[model samples]
Target: MLLCSLVAIIPLLYSVDAEQSLSANGKVLELDESNFDLAISAFDFILVDFYAPWCGHCKRLSPQLDEAAPTLSSLKEPIVIAKVNADKFTRLARKYDIDGFPTLKVFMHGVPVEYKGPRKADLLVRYLKKFVAPDVSVLDSDSAISNFVEASGPHFPIFIGFGLNESMISKLAEKYKKKAWFSVAKDFSEDIMVSYDFDKVPALVSLHPSYNEQSIFYGPFEVEFLEDFIKQNLFPLVLPINQDTLKTLKDDERKIVLTFVEDETEESSKKIIKLLKAAASANRDLVFGYVGIKQWEDFTETFEANKKTPLPKMVIWDGDEEYFSVIGSERIDEEDQATQISRFLEGYKEGKTIKKRISGPSFLGFINSLIGIRTVYMIVFIVAVVMIIQTINKDDEEPPGVGTREQGDNASSSVSEAESKEYRSGEKED
Candidate 1:
């Protein structure tokens, strides 16, 4: 009977395994080692999911990808969704350097770029849609430029390429589309070019309509040079310290001069920010950032600035060295705050400034960090010792019993009375 049941179950399990290899909805292409290169090269944009059959995350993502396929296929330039079983094709997985299951890579022009965005179908579709549109829009006349600017909000900066075409500026536009709007013009009116101070062809100009600020780059059209020019001129001199801004600051090797203000909109904070802007302009090597003390109390405490520390305090955090120095508020609040900051920068460069390590919430934080997970063991040990001591102290007390001789005498008198009453009853009966 057992052999017969095993034979029946074996065929059922085999059928189930065969069905697992089939597509969820026949939308995504299953490419193996033999056809991987051909499929990737055929599509201009292809998102490949390198996954393993046994991976639970891969199983969950498969349905989402299946649902997203129809939407992705409706784009102007459709993106193909492909999957590779990394476990089955070890060599192909190693070729793409697949270290984990369900690795999504976006391939464009046969080049693979790792996709790090959200895993949701809607987000994936939206992210892939950006690739469908031409990166650089061609603006033929002055009216076109104006219309484009009007269409896009004032929040987006405009990068205009004069005497350039889409191909010349496409890569730059694609790289910075999320940051700014890119446009190209083959020819512009002399007045327009002169207004932007455009002296050469293939020039890149960043225009900020809201701030009435414009920056022009007339040098080489190399990626690194253009990126540096845009980044340097795009952001404000003084930046707010938040997660995004902190990431940008940490990416560079510059010393960050950050000010912690109690209230961001207060007059004092604004004044200090203005002063820091001047200092930043004079010293381009240092980055200036500010944070509201109340909103980011935990961030301030990372630098050991607690309630005891003065407000609007400036601290220089050296990312490379992993140390910081607190600039005196008196110096920061002085009439010549910029000069004081400049001198502080010089002192820091000359190694005359004192450096301090990043602090934690309390002294226990240091011990806890040093001990790591053993801190939990230490806590449990201490609690056990305390409980044992309490139990021993409790047991040392006398057990409850007859506490006074007067109570004992009362008990004895009651017993004697009862005995006498019984004896008198017996005598009466006799």
Candidate 2:
């Protein structure tokens, strides 16, 4: 009887293991405290969604995750998608600091980083593909180059070196791998040069597809020059001013010579940007960025730019709350825009500018919220309401119509108890 029982138990265990293996193959695995560690350990790259069922965003995101799971799992090195009911598994939520519902984190070798990409299935797949891609992809043909660029999508900058040795870029490629896509083209035609608009061999071309911009550098490919070119091209010649774009500037120490126009689509604004681009290329020491009052009125107004102040205005921003405006070059007229910009630069260099603070919090401060600020505020409000209700219930439970002195003592005791409970609650949260 003992031998028969052992034989049956072995088969049962094998079947359980097989079921788990199949579940992880191409489906979104449902995980909890018990199996969360095992699941993360099993996959090199796993995207885990810590969600609460009652969250509307989580409910909507569920189907997108299901749709993306199979495609991601079918890759050369599969990426597993898993979800945890963080509300039910309080320990897991606490460990990951899941303050908001439907928090997505991509775990690489058991290290977690918050996922701030798109939520749709297709965009999410493209975004996550960046994490798994090789640091430097080698392209042997024009078609391969095209295919690689297409697969890379338009989210990050792309650096492709033609007729250049792989060893030349391998180090910088690995160093800046997370911020940009690096690749080498082993063979290509002169038509390719004309296509990418480079006239020389051993040339490095940087493409910002989203911005419809490209830059090329030929020769002097020493390590320092190459690295400097790569760093400069990480941002487009004239960067656009937006929340996402501003986040990219946090690490860049260069101050922004920013221009504000009434509307970016206007012919005058387009002309202004063209002039700005010329200045940007000549003066790579300063970053050139532009914002349209029509596009981002709130941001533009922070610099004191308005329809009445001047249609085309300029400022030098420290990527924070403070900006400096040139005394005489604050406004650019239509007839003499180029000369005015030159004067503005000269004035800035001569210390002919006034320093002022932005009206509100810096853009980077708002972008630092792991989840959206509205969601964080909502969570705080809900917790405060619950604590208030609990305190009221405790007060109601007190015995009615005690002696005056006794009632006062009871009230003090109740207040003290509430304060202690609140402090303990904060401690546990921390």
Candidate 3:
């Protein structure tokens, strides 16, 4: 009976373990070191989550992945959601340089691309849908180009490669598909090319239909050149400073002039933006951005800005040097703000203004420096010595009752003598 019971419990435990290994939706593939390469080769588009069992974020992401797996698997060109336990499979983790847990990488044709978008299920599914279509669509006619531009939503920029092979720009298109729409036209009319002032084959043009702005790059279809061209022209003259834009500005080696305004709708903020636009246009070397102090309270705290520091205040941040400077003794207004910014720029270039280092809270360090550690110890010792001396002096003083009894006796004797004298005088008078 005992042997039979042990056999029954072992099979039940195995069944439970098998069920736990499957995804919540039961559609995702579970891969390990033995079959990772085989599965990567099998699937055209696979999203792999490199995770550790001990990671809290990985546990949170597991449910989302399971929920999204079935929907993604049902697509016409399905995407496979697979995962590897990085802690268990050390070799695979090291191969991918998996430094962080819950890292998502999208594999296309066995090549891995890091997925940097949001981690939610809906967002991940939407981003994966891009891989279902070709990276670069071919536009056969002029109307097709216009229709494509009109069909693409207003926010995304459009890139059209004229007389270039599909293979020439496919990789670039795939890399930046989230940022912009990419298309190629093989037999584009010379007239269209001339309109954009393109004089060579393999020419590329980036168009912003909403703003009626276009940029032309004539030669060098190399990845580096095209990337730089797109980056320089993709954004507006002034950018909003967020984590993404801040990294881009730092990578571009551009000094930032960050304006802290009260609110976006204020008249002063509007004027400051206009002035910043003019300044950015004139000084392409500097990146300009503005933050509303009310909206982003933490940003002001990070920069140590407060009510004492006036709003519509501009500060220059040198990303390379990791220091910042503020304008001295002058208020910036709509009329003279541009002049003041230009002067500030000139002063920065000539090293005339003071710069504060970017550092964490140093209140303790400041106090320590104001009064040296040795001086603090010395002061404490002196205070302790004075207190000890005062306590000793207090102990040495006499108590109040030491002579009170004798004084009372003397007073009693004097009273008795005075009574006797009064009695003798009365007897003599009788």
Candidate 4:
């Protein structure tokens, strides 16, 4: 329902990847030596049913899994259903205490939660239901989404970004029936554009996927490239949530600044407080925040499940370990330093909760890329269709391979006398 478009990319060397196997209903993911490390970090849950193709129990379970594949993905982040050849991952099977033919284990947020036995579809579905996040409840997403679209506008609203540094088009919103119509923002500001897929920040092109994206700016770009990208790759989108809603008192009139303070200890927290107080007093409209990697887990847990907001991770890794070394063993914030942050962010319009309906077009685009777009799929489908048509057009083109009235009488008599040892080798088996 959340627009899942699992894609598979087979290597030229014929290596099979479980994540890629998620491309279709019948294929299950396989975790091997090469990608096991990266696979662990890729998702929230993984339900691995390690089994073999020959075993009857495994055979029953395999088809059953395919039937329920569509439902299993309802988790906030769907579990990767990995199918390993015990012969291939023999050590892996023994590591987890699996001795049977069909063993299923559920992993939650990258940690193994529990194991359940071979069961029928109904029981398996019921058991598998417990491991996913509450927000990702299974339901008929297609019907619900179609109904939702009907309730929305007939107009397919599209917005284009114009310049180098992107500006909030909301700054240019127009008045309609006593309300402002949404704006089309243009980015013409900085020289660089940022995206998630690239190892570094800038590139020839960047992709911001929708696996967990609620809203997307993906670009803090300049106008020309922004306009070029819009016309080429992306569909028209309704920019629902604007900058005025994300933060308070942002003004391009002054330089909008961001700096990551290395505050690991309480003493450093104190120093940061002092620094912010001085900066805020000197420049009334600058934005600042701290990113503490040590506290990231707890910070992200609620933000992810309850608020449905993505976690903001820090660039620094050893914040907790080097806290004292970095900040001189002191807390951030003196009395007045703590006071201002509380007052500013509390009722600020930028941090205020927005209860409006979120736009879905951007997410749909991401889904299409993941599941719908592929040259290989098109070629395969076209070939199948052509084969079917050729079979039909052959109608009476020639005699049916083995036996046909169209063949000459001498040929038919000769075939009968050969005792069909040749015909048996070439014929389709019942």
Best by TM-score: 2
How well does each candidate superpose onto the true structure, as a TM-score? 0.52, 0.75, 0.57, 0.27
Residue 134 lDDT, candidate 2, scale 0-100: 88
Clashing pairs in 3: none
Model 4 misplaced stretches (Cα beyond 4 Å) = 1-27, 74-76, 134-430
lDDT of 2 by residue, 287-371 (tens): 9999988888767766777666766889999987789989988789988888999999999989998999886443333333424
- When 3 and 4 are scored with lDDT, the better candidate is 3
Model number with the top lDDT: 2
* Candidate 2 lDDT score at position 116: 66
How many clashing residue pairs appear in each of the predictions shown?
Answer: 0, 0, 0, 31
Q: Which lDDT tens digits does candidate 1 get at residues 120-194?
A: 787677656655556788888888877766655455567888876677667767776655678888657888877
For candidate 2, the lDDT comes to 0.81
lDDT of predicted model 1: 0.68
Regions of candidate 2 where Cα sits further than 4 Å from its true position:
1-23, 50-60, 85-103, 265-267, 305-309, 361-430
- lDDT, candidate 3, equals 0.68
* Clash-forming residue pairs, model 1: none
Question: Could you tell me the TM-score of candidate 3?
Answer: 0.57
Worst ten in a row by lDDT for model 4: 316-325
